[model samples]
Target: MTLLPDLVSRAAGRHAQRDAVVMGSRRLSYAALEQASNRLARSLIAHGVRRGDRVALWLPKSPEAVVALYGVMKAGAAYVPVDPGAPPARMAWIARNCEVAGLVTCADRIARVDEAFAGRPPMRALWVTDDAADAPRVAGLPTVTWPALAAESAERPAVPAVDADLAYVLYTSGSTGDPKGVMLSHRNALAFVEWAGDTFGVTSEDRLANHAPFHFDLSTFDLFAAARAGAALYPVPPRLFAFPAAVAKSWCEQRLTVWYATPSTLVLFLTRGGLASLDLSALRVLLFAGEVFPVKYLRELMRLAPHARFANLYGPTETNVCTWYDVKGIPADDAPLPIGVPCCNDEALVLDESLKPVPGGGAGELWVRGATVMQGYWGDPGRTALALQSIEVAPGISDRAYRTGDIVRRRADGDLEFLGRRDHQVKTRGYRVELGEIETTLHRHPAVDEAVVVAIPDEEITNRLKAVVVTRPGAAVSEADLRQHCAATLPRYMVPEAIEFRAALPRTSSGKVDRRALQELSS
Candidate 1:
């Protein structure tokens, strides 16, 4: 299927009576989901949402959220997913940045939406999943209830989207400023989905768990792969994420055969989630990505789930998934598993600063070129061009490739071993963050003179962000006060878990901040 909506339509035709999505006690059949999305699509068109328009989806993970995703695509619009747990300011910034034409959310969250808009949102219309008499109504913008939309004609709308059309826009942290949207086309997403399906041999009998949030790229495989194979997609409740025992019980209860999530999440289950003793007999495939799986955790997990096949999938959000490594039994305590070979239709090259290939397994920046590369950052051509560059692969042979900004060493066997990033960027709890961004936000505080942020590795949490700030002479600021300041302007994940106030910061010979000194302090 070229367009993403076609996946849903074709699945509905084949698995009409089969369950397409399961959330808690609610189950939506393929036919029912298709009809629901069709009605919602018609309502969107009625409310002046034209093709190529952007629609924002802000809601807790639920069956209706899934329906709205497909509905937005069916209307020939790209859906922008906003994390419901995001601060009001972050939400507002994302909606404003994307210039969303409308919003799809629930009644309970209308207050947050209003707070985000600050009484004057740019959206032209709003669709509340549940519209009760008590639901707050905004002035000027037309409001449509879920029931009202469901009452509209269920006939499929003729949206005419092609493979080249934008499918979705996922926002990630930016090094220069706030978050930037990564624009992905239908072709980019389908390339990864088709590869995952064929690689894993997914079938209708498989039951997959949607562990990642809709805003995360990992959810793309869990959602589309299941649909492509006519399999059941089970949406794991967000609340159960903290309680490992409950998460394990839910996995067993749902009889999930395929699982995908961050390595930190899997480690949480094994340590605190009581997954080691649980009966996961039906689980056949286990996939982890987004961060480096600690060697100790990887060995322990392999011992616990010997019956399951484990694989490490690695890539940045800019490129869906470039390389994958399937675990071959258990490894030594010091051995880190390679990131493995490139997926179908993809290639990974270790190139130097001049875009020349590194020889004899030397460490260099990892660059990738493939159908899975995103089209570009939305509305930011300059930044897109910088990230996407043309590099010569052979004598006078060149291809446009994404500069991954990661350093890795190639093994003799053609496997790639990940080292670290080329910049201050780090992956903490499956989310990519720019240390300079946090320091920039910290510098905004009046009492702060200089600040440096570093990623501190922890046993339990993969990595924790720590900030060391040097206050202006005689200016006093408590950690609590600085944390509150950050919490107000930044997302919860971006906030520093630990803060230190120092009288002065160490500097290098050239007067630049000595980040290595700060690292030693954290250590």
Candidate 2:
């Protein structure tokens, strides 16, 4: 298929009556999904959503959300997914930054949506996917309810788009205190989806677990790969994450054949999900990514599900899964696992500060060149230029590649061993976060004079964030107050796990904040 919607169209023809998406006993057949998405697309088009316009999805993960995303793309517009649980201010900032022409949200979030767009140029349209009868209408905005949306024509829209056209934009934390949107085209997503479907040998008989949130890149594989292979997709409920046992039960009940999620979630399952007592023989392929998988926990998981094969997928949002490693046997030790070779028709290069390839066995930043790399950061040319640069692939031959900013060392066996990040960016619970972003938020508090955010290494979640702050003289701010302040503007995951008030932040002789010392203190 040349475009993303083509996946759904082909699947509908091939597996018309087969289950496509399943959420809490609600199952949508391939034909039904196609028709629903087509109707939604027509609704969007009728509301003035034109080709190339940006549409934002701010709903929780549900069948309606899935339909909304496909419908947005079918309307010849790229869908920007906003974290449904994020603060209204943050979501509004993203909406404004991308200049979204339309939004798809639920009744519960309409108030916050109004708050977000209060004084800004109103969106062209707002779609409420559920509880429309009780949803309060906002002034000066055209709102469509589920009933009205469903009444639209089910025939596919005739809007023209190409494989290179934008498909989606995912926002990631930025060092400058604002989230940046990573633009991916249909070809970019198809490259990775095609690879994942082939690598795992997904088929209509396969039941894939969609554990990652739609906003996360990992969900791309879960969503598109299933559609590509005509497999059934089961979206794990977000609330089940707090109860690992419930998560395990859900997988067992679904008889999922393929499972993909972050290491932190797997660790939770291993420790408390009661996997030892469950029947997981149906799970055939297991994939983990977004952070280093502690070898101990992974090894235990391997023991628990001996029939399943596990692979570690690695890449930044800029390049969706550039490399991956298959666990052939039980890990020998607690040493970090290699990220393995490049996948999805991608090339990986270990380069030094000068952009020259690093000699074998030496550590350097990882650079990737391939079809799967993102188009660019949405609306930010300077940052895009800095991330995507022309680097030498061969003698007198240079190609555009994304600088991953992740440090790695080539193993003696040719595999790339992941070292760590080259910057203050860190992964916590599979979410990429910039320490400077949190520090900037902390500084915004009137009582804070100086603030720094440090990551403390943890085996379970990769790293736990801790905030150290120096208050302005006589300014009384408790840790809870600072945390509440952060919660107002940041996602729950980005909020510092622990906050400390100090008389003064330790500084280096050169007058810079001693981050290293702060990390040591936090640890």
Candidate 3:
């Protein structure tokens, strides 16, 4: 019923000449990539990865990384990717929680991976790289290496059934707790890819930039969409994101035709290079999502890439892309563009707290109903029930939907306009901040006693990741120093925008952050 593997199979079978994935200095045609994935899939099955098994892929963005992703799925297992750059703790967390049958990583990653999962009984890892074959150059988890076992792998198994079988176990932070898995089925994934390809005018000629981590669900489209459209997907290095000018330079050099990433990233490129410095002449489309995009920056980008189409893409990991806004021209007013119309096979509803639909122009929580909705969260029945289920729909129908937690309003044009989240939780670009996550990080600073992170809207950075962290008496660390400390522990996106020492945080009768009160004061 789903065509994910077959789509790749067909691309090889029929469109073999098309380019599948492109990285610096290497080009993989669909036919060749398909053969590589097939061989890898056979190796996985030979290693005992059965249908519906979980295969954790912890590697950087490279041709091999792409091979492992499709290979795992081709072998009929869910491919769960953990960013190679993640700290040992975060890597172990995702691995243990997802209960991966095995992991595929490079030798550079072996030491940290072994250190984290050393005690976990069910997990094993495989490494690739270096004169790996010479003199046991590979060590640590001597038992864990994929290439060594490939020869032992006897045969490739048949593709698994599409019905109720998982295609991926993409992990996203749990709304109320630690990270949890969102089970996206073959049907769930294929529906989105198919819909996105057609809806966004994605074609074989389109060349997209992949900026999101392989672990993040957004990259699912970036990776698979390339195969789906027979287009080339260029995975940018983390360094380019930091030095966006270099990225802009590469855009000109590579002739990148389409861009899909978070708004924060685009703003950096525009701010760093300005539109005039970069040669974006070949760029025809700019699709952005994962956070609120500022109107000023978008308008500037439109002017810069005058020929490129600007699109507002909105969705969550649980619901693969529910809506889109095609930037036909600058909106007459400046209130950031609406999240736009729902995609084919998708429906959006803005509902009040009681689950009643909000009237036009009234703000409420957004709920998505569609074929693209995920099966459920992995392992947690309580949360799975909360996120995936019936929500203000025909009482008798058996279909389910997802509650996005984002608040928005239906505009007069029938498009959805952006509002903030229903809670203190805020998103920076594509990453979700639990507010509590940052506060917990602040509490770790030796000089800090307690802290509260608040989201303040700004045109450039979008959400002001400001922290009102309380310091102990005579503590040495300052605001800027605290940011450096955070950079060591967390990714740059998670670092607090501004750190302010406080005597005590305000609180409501419930003694929460008194978030509303803090907002009023900040305003």
lDDT against the true structure, each candidate: 0.87, 0.91, 0.75
Cα-based lDDT at residue 454, candidate 1: 88
Give the TM-score of each candidate: 0.97, 0.98, 0.90
Tens-digit per-residue lDDT, 138-191, candidate 3: 233334344554453333357647646888887765434366788988788777
Please give, for residues 1-523, the per-residue lDDT of candidate 1 as tens digits: 4688788888999988888998888999889888999999999999988899989998889899999999998999999998777777887888998999899989988877887787898888999988645798876778898878757888889987788888899998888758889998889889999999888888988999998989999999998999888889998887776687897789987789999999878888888887877888889899999988888888888787788889899889889988999888656556878899999488999998888899999999999998888888888899999999988878887888999999998999999999988898988888888888788889889999988998898776668999999899888889998998888767788899999887788899999988998898798
What is the Cα-based lDDT of residue 82 in candidate 1? 83
Best by TM-score: 2
Deviating ranges (above 4 Å) for candidate 3: 125-131, 134-156, 175-177, 395-398, 441-449, 471-492, 509-511, 516-523
Question: Where does candidate 1 clash, by residue pair?
Answer: 244-273
Q: 219-337 in candidate 2: lDDT tens per residue?
A: 99988999998899999876675788998889987799999999999898878898878899899999999999888888888988888988999999999999999888755666788
Pick the winner on TM-score between candidates 1 and 2: 2
| Candidate 2 global TM-score | 0.98
Clash pairs detected, candidate 2: none
Q: Of the candidates numbered 2 and 3, which has the greater TM-score value? A: 2
Candidate 1: lDDT of 400?
88
